[model samples]
Target: MPAFDIQTARFNMIEQQIRPWNVLDSGVLDLLASVRRDEFVPPEHKALAYADLEIPLPGGQYMLTPRVEARLLQDAAVQKTDSVLEIGTGSGFLTALLARRAARVLSLELSPELVAFAKSNLQKAGITNVDVRQGDGSQGAAAQGPFDVIVLGGSVADVPHKLLDQLKIGGRLAAIVGDDPIMRATIITRTSATDFRTSQPWDCDAPRLQNFAQVSRFTF
Candidate 1:
């Protein structure tokens, strides 16, 4: 078998998959180019690193597809001085991106193994601004937060109010919300002390985040 050309594949991923998905921000485009996503991928799935699929992780969770990840980062509008909170730090790929764009990032993961995996990957990648913690990230990191940005690295039935409350006034939270097979990438911005505005910028799909509250339903 011929050896794969990684740089060419990365360029194609940016042009062929992510750029066409409306991820046009120059900063994000550069991030996609600079971050070595293959390093964060599980060893077995390393070959699929630049592919357009959500490569599987140790748990049932998945790395968000490259386009979705880029779009989420762009929509969140992270700034160099922003302190960010990231939920579900699957492989720390998104965490690394957030770290680059934000002043600091606190990433929470439910699985211990993934936390270790993510920490190792981030350390190897020389990302020092991210702190990966093992916890129930479905609940917002209240004590440490009131953050400028929050990113859910997976889909949820709905964005929880607790997480919304963690955002500082004028801050933004990006999440993919809906059931399986279909979902929309949404941004909820805190407009005032008690007000938040929700917008679905684009449609995408991802595996459900564990432990998020689902919308209630009735049955006869």
Candidate 2:
């Protein structure tokens, strides 16, 4: 086991990088303090676990920066009774964090390899409330319909309609919007049966998830 001061470094990073960028949720802070990020990262990359940079995974996928991950978790405003939908389960670190905050969490991963790894990570962390599934997140997890909070791990060109259909009224969805260089993280909440509102939280950069990549319709 890699031994490092997890809580102290996590607290410092949360205060220095994340809080400066407007992350002030006590719940989120607590979750970050409790969950050990180093455990989820590759043994060789464990030193970079809390750095404010993306961590490369086995696949082409990478874990979001600690700041971005913390920001998303804070913006979600997770409740103990809420059920969460996580679109990408990279290392299961964030999934475990959500498992601690939410009543239940369903995370979908496009890579079977990642899904298997995540399940092992989650098990190692002793988290039982999170369900990791292998599938296309954009198509949406219909069987686990009506999530109270839906979170996409990567930026999307637009919010998938299928995701909107799966949110219960008054539910919230947090995702990074736009493409490349300049993308803003946002939250969309269903206020009523017919009303929805969107809020931009902060600037972030996340690789597009294969599950939610926009399709090209024409070639010139």
lDDT by residue (tens digit), candidate 1, 51-146: 999999997889999999999999999999999999999999999999999999999999999999999999999999998999998887999989
Native-to-model Cα distance after best TM-score fit, residue 16 in candidate 1, in Å: 0.1
User: Residue-pair clashes per candidate, as listed?
Assistant: 0, 0
- Backbone clashes, candidate 2: 0
Q: Pick the candidate with the highest lDDT.
A: 1
Tens digits of lDDT, candidate 2, 1-220: 3355666677678888888878788778777877889889877888788888889987888998888888898888889999999999999998998889999999999999899989999999999999999989988887878999999888898898789888999899999988778799999999888788999967878988885657456978
**Each model's TM-score?**
0.97, 0.93
TM-score of predicted model 2?
0.93
- In model 2, what is the error at residue 212, expressed in angstroms? 1.9
lDDT score of residue 20 within candidate 2? 85
Tell me the spans in candidate 1 whose CA falls farther than 4 Å from its real position. 1-4
